[model samples]
Target: MEKKPNDVPKPNKENTISLEIAKDWTKRWRDMESTYNSHHDCRAFNIPLIDLQEVIKEQGVVSVRGYIGVEETVVEGDTVFIEKLIIVGVDANGKDMISSKDGLILDQESDDIYDFSDPCPNLCDPKSPLNG
Candidate 1:
């Protein structure tokens, strides 16, 4: 009746990052941030499958791409522009796929940009085998 990390789906071997490697990389990032006293509790982003599906439903969108960004927010009373992952739809040409209702370049500000994915350390899979 309770969920645990093992409840999370196992990584696909095709492009999987091993548990050891993931831990190492995360540790490196934390170490660097700790030196500056800017350590964050976040470790990953949770992009739901349904949200990703919605992005790819747009015309000409063949895939989604994630970019690292920074935005000012308070963490334990410290204002910081923490690194966040922003996901955007990508067209076949590898361009950010923005839609035009009139089939033209102009569109509303809410076009195809997506963010606000739930960050980890809170939403992460508990005790995941992959060290999530």
Candidate 2:
């Protein structure tokens, strides 16, 4: 398996970004797209620490990785494409722990991929400074 999201050779507690940098990057995304932070764009997602711990508790999982993705959805009776963050378990070698069966390529619908994060704008902290 190859490291796709982080692109690192191995996992060792890296990939931490400062809050100010995160805020700026999020702000840039919000400013770059008109739909960002709006009904058409998915700004962020929230996952509980306890829930994330469950994924991390898997054997050989050393870190979690996230990938940007899009899904077909409808809002206000209109079809739309909203971005989402697809998180998954990463092994010590920095490879995604995607589940496979019978030696076949990983299926997109595999239950190992964690994509149930609560989307923002509808379920967000209105008072949080990170909402920008």
Candidate 3:
């Protein structure tokens, strides 16, 4: 799916962005690749997940502290964990490097939903999300 200009993720007040692939899109695109390079169409637009990550990293910073928020789910009363991840970065001296924090912006509006679980299970866990 095409990411709308406003759908871009952003950094928090402390300055940080999240890095995550659209799971469904990634899986589907990767799966199609496994079949017969069906992902060539996606390749045309250069919207691959890796490329997107690079853009995020270049534009903002990755948040070390994962955040959690409520998300609508396919199952009733089954809330999903909106994973807090990062994309932007800071220098060794701890300074904001990215000029545009827009890359770190997230769609946390009421209609914008996400999973509460950490997209990176190894990095950020439930505890962080819960407290976040």
Report lDDT (Cα) of residue 26, candidate 1: 39
Give per-residue CA lDDT, model 1, range 84-104, as digits (tens): 455667878988655455543
- TM-scores for candidates 1 onward, in order: 0.54, 0.56, 0.25
Task: Kindly list the per-residue Cα lDDT of model 2 for residues 1-132, writing each as its tens digit.
Answer: 321232111222233222222233334445545654454646678777766776687778889887654444456767554444556778878887775564333444432544444677577888889887
What residue runs in model 1 are displaced by over 4 Å at the alpha carbon?
A: 1-38, 74-83, 99-106
**Best candidate, TM-score:** 2
lDDT of 3 at 125: 39
Q: Candidate 3 lDDT (Cα, whole model)?
A: 0.32
In candidate 3, residue 11 scores what lDDT? 39
Question: What tens-digit string does per-residue lDDT give for candidate 3 at 1-132?
Answer: 334333243434323223233333223334444543331211111123553344334433433122222222333555332323222334455554433235333344311112222333333333654525
Q: How far is 92's C-alpha from truth in model 3 (Å)?
A: 4.6
Give the deviation of candidate 1 from the true structure as CA RMSD. Answer: 13.9
- What overall lDDT goes with each candidate model? 0.52, 0.53, 0.32
Candidate ranking under lDDT, highest first, comes to 2, 1, 3
